[model samples]
Target chain A: MKGASEWDRHAPSSAPNPRHTRYHPRWHRERIPIFWWVGHRRYTLFILRELTAVLVLYSGLLLLAQLVAIGRGPESYQAFQGWLAEPWVLALHTFVLLGLIFHTVTWLNLAPKALVLRVGKIRVPPRAVLVGHYLAWIAVSALVAGALVWVAG
Target chain B: MSPVAKGAGGRQGTEPERVTRSREPLLWSLFSAGGMASALVLPALAGVLWVAVPAGWVAAPEHGAMLAVAAHPLTRAAVSLLLILFFFHWAHRFRYTLYDGLQLYHLNLLIAVATYGIASALSALALWIVWTLG
Candidate 1:
């Protein structure tokens, strides 16, 4: 490989092999920010958007599977339950929980800006939107959890 | 809306003041509502579903029951509805991300329309498939 100075210069006018002489952006060794790689605005936002629905869809599938097992005889349900009892499933659940938390944070952060709820002169801050979403998420999650505990009890 | 328009599409001289229109808010409003509901509902439901599995309050479905549940008309309808609304919210949100993030002038409207159109069309296809043979 040529020195940085050599790479900086334009392709030679008499280079026999044009492709080799041509300077690639990589030749400059410019460090792209980690955020630039798929973490750029489009992909990051796309993934963030999809992650929520994906969680919902996967959860739906999981719940539907359990519901089906329940619909079957007790024996079948027990077997499916055993599978869920595995350590792997617990690990997966923990991972999903972390993902959900991330989703909630990003979603709430974007929520105010997304809604763009504004007054005449002073616009509502994005942080306010996020705080509102957090309060709602916490309340709803608590209510659902409470209801589940009650039913399960 | 300022009269000192300097961007590529901004008017040169004295265009009608009426021409200064804010972007449409109808779709944005609908999406905001739907997003809020989904953001609230899904996470809540997820918690319920998660707990029920461990507590044995809800029986686990065999693969067959899972398939059958998918086959059920109500379940199929719910899934399809979720898919459509999710896509609508996603496309709407992403369009703004593209506009604001990339600063692609003059293409924002086109991109937004295209994104939503594709999402809607795909969602329709998914609904049709699930409804027919979910």
Candidate 2:
């Protein structure tokens, strides 16, 4: 066998042989492109989370309008309903509802990461917060839906 | 600074001042969660409000309590405050939805401007209605 110095001088640390594996095939394949690697930027993520608030604002605005129309008179309120029932407005509302659902799911997922409230010395898990929010939303939604159905019945 | 250090020309880690409420993760999460909850609850409430008020099942309060508040100086100030905060909140949230949901990055700036502009206009309209009613 060659001495250490002699071996170091002649032998390559990275080998050319196929079995030697100077380059990893998996690593090369797994490497993400620069832009793709960014996935989504923080600013984008922040804005995405904020979509829920926008949805709330929009709903509030519409509700306020409905109230104002009712205040004006039944005819005006009926006219407002006619406008809302338009295909385009209904479509927009449907689209916004779907968006709100997505926003809710994402926001719930991030809640734990965003809030690390400790109950005494015990730290509350993020999942718990998410589940709580979802549960509350479901409960509130159900209550309103039930009331609507009851009234309609 | 090295290109590598600057996230390869991306924004630095520090959040912009206007958007920065604080770094408390719990508060941020709760706020976001609250926003989301409100998003869900408000729409459903709006539906109830829509049906009840029109069906004469429930009286619309905005015409009375809300309008009365609008008439008062203190309440008018409060209403304006709510409108502004709510508009900003809407803008802050819509900016994100547009950025992520729509793959139309080419139209990102337009979407941002439109979302915010519409929200501001709507808030203004709400204020206008309140003032007129009051």
Candidate 3:
């Protein structure tokens, strides 16, 4: 919590001090290159994971826009649908779909790290946790799809 | 002034501005919740809205039906929560992305405020839209 001023006060004095002349050999820590993430596969994957948030943001905004369009009435909703029919919009959505899939898969895979299950003194395997997540995901998706079908019919 | 008093003053003066201002835990918690929510629902949303409807694999809902869905109290509340969490999730992710990706550690405060501020504003707009839907 030391302020910058405090750090400055205790900084190595520019003026040479007799007491500060001890020489020591130490390995130089590697500087994080600007492209450090690109240099490592794991780091690259982490960055991609983080970048999925942009897709989430885009999707959220799109949902809001759709809601606004719906509020404005049928013509507005039709206009919005027309806009979405453009090739560029479709392409953007394709990318968003990929990003969303990546996000979902990664999140599910990481679920075991956050959720530890044990029963009767036996710890659940990570694979079992992953299976549980996938099962729950499918169930929820089916529920949503079923609801939509029920509503539409 | 006594040396002890001067020392105390110096110690107080040198405390880093950010030391007392960390919101890491709060932001991380929101990000985690948002991630879980998005994981649960977003892919299905994308499938329905972007894939099935657009590709003509399924019929698009009539405007009246869509409106009805949006106007439902439960739908409105769920959507509002989802959108708010999504924004916070984006804020937290983008903050770290800039910090590590762009090496913007020196401008941490500015970046944090900008990211979270935008999220807050958008969340407000989203809530307003949901709340006012007929």
Candidate 4:
């Protein structure tokens, strides 16, 4: 774009060079504002999806803390459980649950696009992919719940 | 003036150019695995731990049983993998969030380092906790 205007730029377009093909970027994206995602519904949902990364990150850390508490002994573990029982913790978990559920639903919807499955010759349909994700989610969730309940009993 | 191509060696006065192999694919794989794992099981786990058990909607598992399960080598390994994948997922998502949402591409390298650094550090912590448990 820089040198094209001053010279015979149409030379390449009109009579293409068989040997060399010079490349130039055609699309120029405009600068966006910092809070660009705040206004639109779709954009806002994207932001929420991205923010769930933080939720999961903290959740990982909390799991680590629980493990450490477990290693510390029963008394320390009880204290950790007691700490979680605090009203503020529950309130925080309320939002955490919402954000994580959003993450799950949205991520599952994207499974079809990400995973292009095929059995031998025929390509798997996107609907099947979506259904498979939901089914897997349900199965895994049930497995975790069942494991915990089994341990309790 | 005739069109001249730039040299592959970079500028005359600048430092020597370095060929970089991007680790994007590997990071994305981790992110994908993490996203899937978290999405599948996190809601139920979070509900059980942070809400149901804490809020008294459900009974908590016995201490001995929990300790026994956590002590198991299989459980420890599974948890370690989960934590590592989860952290990488966070790193990738948060990195892009800052890149696109706030348009902070100028600090691209720094943001990348910081986000992945946190992930790596926390992953080590998670591993240590799991290894030392039970």
Best by TM-score: 4
lDDT of 3 by residue, A1-153 (tens): 988887565443531332232355766977777778997899999999999999999889999999999999999998988887677887788788889989999999999999999998999998999999999889878877766655555
The local distance difference test score of each candidate is: 0.59, 0.57, 0.82, 0.83
Model 4 chain A, poorest ten-residue lDDT window? Answer: A12-21
Where's the lowest-lDDT run of ten residues in candidate 1 chain B? B12-21
Looking only at chain B, model 1 earns a TM-score of: 0.63
- What TM-score does each model's chain B reach against the true chain B? 0.63, 0.49, 0.84, 0.83
Candidate 2 TM-score to native: 0.50
Is 3 or 4 the stronger prediction by TM-score? 4
What TM-score does candidate 3 get on C-alpha atoms? 0.82
Check candidate 3 and list the clashing pairs. A3-B14, A3-B15, A3-B16
Q: True contacts preserved, each candidate?
A: 0.15, 0.30, 0.56, 0.78
Give one digit per residue, the lDDT tens place, for model 2 in B1-134: 32333332222222222123343353344345446545446546655554444444454343344334435776456545555555655665565555555444445546556765776687787777666653
Please write out the lDDT profile of model 2 over residues A17-85, one tens digit for every residue: 212323446634453333341456874565555555766676667756765775576577568866766
In model 4, residue pairs whose N, Cα or C atoms come closer than 3 Å (at least 3 residues apart or on different chains), thus clashing, are none
Sort order, lDDT high to low:
4, 3, 1, 2
Query: Whose DockQ is greatest here?
Result: 4
Query: Over the stretch B1-134, how does candidate 1's per-residue lDDT look in tens digits?
Result: 42224332434222322232343466666456546655765665654555455545565434444456566887677766766665666566666665544645456556766867876786766666566652
| Deviation from native of the Cα of residue B94 in model 1, angstroms | 11
* Model 3, runs deviating above 4 Å: A1-29, B1-22
* lDDT by residue (tens digit), candidate 4, A1-153: 569665566454433442233566666998677888888999998898899999999889888888888788889889999999999998998889899999999999999998899999999999999998899999999998888767867
TM-score, first chain, each model = 0.62, 0.61, 0.75, 0.79
How does the DockQ of candidate 3 come out? 0.43
